[model samples]
Target chain A: MSVLDRLAPELITGAPLLVMQGIAKRYGPVVALEDVAATVWPGEVLGIVGESGSGKSTLLRMMNLEDTPDTGTYTLALPEVAGNLFDLDRFARRQLCARRIGIVYQNPHQGLLMGHSSSGNVAERLLVAGERRFATLRARAREALDVSEFPLNRMDDPPRLLSGGMQQRVQLAKAIALEPALLLLDEPTTGLDVSVQALVLDTLKRLQRDRAITMVIVSHDLGVIRTMADRVMVMRRGRVVEEGLVDQVFQDPQHPYTQELVHAKL
Target chain B: MPNSERGAMVPGAVVLQVEGLAKSFQMHHLGQNLHAFDHVSFTLRAGEFLLLKGPNGVGKSTLLRTIYRSYLPQAGHVWFSHGAGRTDLAHAADVDIALLRRREIGFVTQFLIARPRVAAEDIVAEPLRKAGVAAEDALEQARHWLATFGVKRDLWRAYPTSFSGGEQQKVNLARALILPPRLLLLDEPTASLDVGARAALVARLADLKAAGVAMIGVFHHPGDVAALVDRDLMLMAKEVDDVAV
Candidate 1:
């Protein structure tokens, strides 16, 4: 049975799947992020939009436990786990990052090592997730690549030989090969052509819908933010300036920063 | 010369032309051929921004590498025309052509980086070292380029890999453009850039074009191609389509 199935129906239906309280991060004299509080419920997509240096990336990294917050309370909805992300032990957090949470970076090159082949890239994550059978892992990787629309016949080609769009599809396949519950996408389609961007976004939407994977997408493109988000958070100067449903944020933005961002792209 | 007069190039006066271009990769596991580019062809004018666009595995990046002579084309011919001379790059000696490449072409890859932990200022200055320019002068020029892209001056001695994605892209652009070449080949130059940094790149490319420096931009973003390209050349799944923008 799935983790969700084992939880109390009341807890599964009503509680926030992930919650952050008084989250803050600092670097020397600079205040990167401060007093950020948010909640991500199951079966929901949360979008984060901000200008450069607004701490969106930093905040996302904090949430993924890639960086430690100076002060914060993070509680994830993992019944099998005993503590929050910050409270978890080293091995536990590593397990969580590798198995439950996955990151898809904007630059596809960053997601996978340049030296590894497509099959190797996919296998690395599956191996880390404790799958040891070689034949089973290879077959699972192939199936995942097929699901992501990757041309599986070129499984051994290194990333350098693949086009940027193709490499991204492979990256997506690797990220989802383990069936992670939370996927953090950092401007996933920022540099792709519009036609290619459309396809990637469509694939992501389909995967989210079919698997009910909770996502936190960080981007400066309002077009992408509008298309994928259920709820939107507008950030500025390391704080949440405004928050609302996607339609509400786009239609009646109350914050000046959000308004500026919307108009700048226009 | 008038604009119309300048637009005219003699028949077969192509500076860079490719015909029946094809390349394939022999995959290890699948044990089959992966065609990087399939029978792609295009003729580029001397000073034009020819944008190549396509979905990821469509061989757009491979086409660029093939054109630059970095990746040898398994088939077809790439002809480069220079004043009073024309040479097929496929037949040129690797070392001699590499020297030509350094002087006449500037190619920036998607995974651009400097030496292991090299300072940003030094990285930019590396290209101009043999130009007889003073070290201080080269650094000044580097700083000028960095400021144009909104990179802080205090980060000059800092390594770019330690910087953010946007910042590293700016440094990469600065390094490639510090010593202007006749042809600039950019692969997704603004991939990690913010709006501010991207605008700076657009403006710089515009200035380079105005100066009659030829550029061939391989970009995915329509906004980027619209900003810098004079024409669009697309590499579809296995076909090449050239269209004037």
Candidate 2:
């Protein structure tokens, strides 16, 4: 069965939780992104697929506010905030990201604290969200760990002690512990084995179904896009070559670039 | 490959044998004794990659250090079989251990400890120089490894102390692998490396294993190097017995 068929039904009727328009970014001498537009609805998974230097990661960084767009109107349906996200100051952006967004990097270690225990890593997000009581933090950490299928007994062990798959699970647990409104995953399974990749993807799918979390996944792996994305955005050289339903894009890619990508994988 | 197939490839003789290995530390201020591990025993074969798996503070590092003679085991024998003969690293004299290290062992740790003014290339070539290799040849090999690890040509003459953590780690790996020792001990060698560098290191390690260099490695992310592992040695807390897979 196709991946989207196994997940919870999409809630397409609701207003989009995020919207971006006219997003453009430029590095010192090169244009990293140009005129990119997208919408992420609640309870939806959007996958961005492209090769290296395609600006998919740059777009993700902008969505997470790690980098500002040179020109764009970005809006997040965050409670008590109605202004454009691009207008927020650095400190405000950091605070909003900490409390409202969860991000998992391509390298699991980048998203984790190597010196801290698994439980400590999970609890850190809660603490950042102003959770002070140890009992409360531990309880929330255990709940998140359970959702990620992390071994409860190994909670006190640091990330260095865990296997690659287990370390990715800890990263997932830490990201979801705060119950962020938006989740950003950047090539989450790029460096893992096929079996381990399947496990990580399954866990992510389960979390999406159970929590109804909105996510933006960026990957060059077509399999990951096919399995996890409800909608796929095909990008090349800083432009969106094609955007459509995952099945539609896979079965009948319109653009030549998208067709080439699909054919190469087949 | 299955463990049996690996064992069959190197028949009859073990590369490293550890028996009754034990170590403990005394906390003078707290007035407590901590035993790292007790009565641990294992056998590693030539061309084998043994992955050490365990929780933090479980003595994986301690066991490796003891085997390398960096830490003196309270009681044990680390019999490393070499071309000449077997040497007991656990009880060997300092000078003998030093000599054996030069020719038989290559250890890569997380940190690099180069002299303040030493250039990156020279730091990597120091081991070969000590082994009496010509300076020009050693530097050439060093430059080759630096390029393989993705260290830029401009950084070859720069001091490692001024390099980034990842750059320093590449230099450390290049230094350790220059001589192709009989036994290699790696402690989180890829911890500080980027994705490209990690892949390069993994490929290089695979070549070394195929060339019959026995290795024991502790990895923070074992998945990156999972293909090379032939067996697993799991160290647990003092209360539980260590498990060998």
Candidate 3:
């Protein structure tokens, strides 16, 4: 049985938390993303599958608001805000990002502060969200670390001293400390050893199921997408070629490019 | 012996012999000595591939470095059999060791240290040039290996220092394998490489094994190299014994 089945059945259900339509982005002469549309429902896990330079990362960056979609209606349904994200001013978008989004990059170093202690790294996210009390910050940080299964004894150790897998755990803890509604992961286990990759994936699965946090994970590894994603989207050359339930797509891929990808994995 | 499918007969005589290998470090701040390994012994035959397995901090990497003569072992002997003669790498003269390294031994580490302004192709060809191959011939051969490792032809002229970790690692592998050394020591060679690059490396290593090159490699994921490895060496952390002052 899938690990997700063991956790409390996803309790959150409502209108999709995020919606994008006709998203298009370009870098000079290069078309990075083109008319890509996706909807992430509350408590859903969406896996974006594509090789390098396939617009998967571009779509993710647009969702994170790191890059604005040149043309599209990007909507994030947060309690306090309801409108196209690209329509917001930079300052307003930044506020919404701080409040509602958590991102974990493929490189753990990019997501983590190597100089700060592990717990300090987790606590810093809360501090940025305006939590000032030391006791509360410490408590929340410890809780997040516990959820990620990071060793509490090494809470004071900087990330540089930790192994690659441990550093990823710390990054996961820090990203989820704020309990954001949406989590964005880009090739989270790409470089980790197989055993360590299993651990990180297990932790992510447990957290996603228990907390019912929505997620969009991008990876070139079909194994990762097969294990983690509830729905799968396949992109090729800056456009979505296929999208469907994970089982449906895996069993009978409609797009020729997706069929080639699935065959390569097998 | 794992009975590798390669079934290539290893040389009857051992290519490398180690006895009573021990290494330790003095932790001055902690006022204690860290024992890396103790009384380690092994023999590697020509054309045999040995996989070193152990957890972190167990001295697997330290043992590899000591064999390469980069790190000094407190007490041990590493006898490397070469065409000229058997040289105790543990106690070899500096000049002899340097010459042996250039001609007989090659080590590939996880990271590459490329000099600034040097093109990737030149970096791969440097070893051959040092060994007295013509620059043109060396570079031509370097291009062949670079292409084998899947490095784009256009990037061959650019500096490797700016390449991504996987790309630089491919360059490092090309440089080490270009000369086709008698004995190769690899530490996590596939750590940074992608699936395609890794498969390419495995294929190249298989070819080298068929050609009778002995190797000792440390792999975090042994399954990746299982088809090539003939034997396994497991290292355990040594318990530190307090020396009474």
Task: Please give the TM-score that candidate 2 achieves against the real structure.
Answer: 0.50
Off by over 4 Å in 2: A1-12, B1-245
By how many angstroms RMSD does model 2 differ from the true structure? 25.4
| Local error of candidate 1 at residue B88 (angstroms) | 74
CAPRI rating of model 3: incorrect
Give the per-residue lDDT digits (tens) of candidate 1, residues A165-201. Answer: 7888888889889888788889988899887887788
Q: What proportion of the true contacts does each candidate reproduce?
A: 0.00, 0.00, 0.00
List clashing residue pairs in candidate 2.
none
Candidate 3, residues A1-266: lDDT per residue as tens digits?
Answer: 21111122122235678899999988899999899998888777899999999999888988888888789998988778878888888888777776689888888778888988999999988988889999999999999999999999999999999998898889888888888989999898889998788778878976875577899999999988877887789999899998766754665465668777887799
| B1-245 per-residue lDDT for model 3 (tens digits) | 21233233356557899877777654433456767897878888888888887788888887888787665567768888877667777666433554567677889898896655568998899887766678799899999999999999999999897899999999999998887677889999999898988998999899888777889999988888999988888786663221211
Model 2 chain A poorest 10 in a row by lDDT: A2-11
Q: Which stretches of candidate 1 lie over 4 Å from their true place?
A: A1-12, B1-245
Error of 2 at B113 (Å): 54
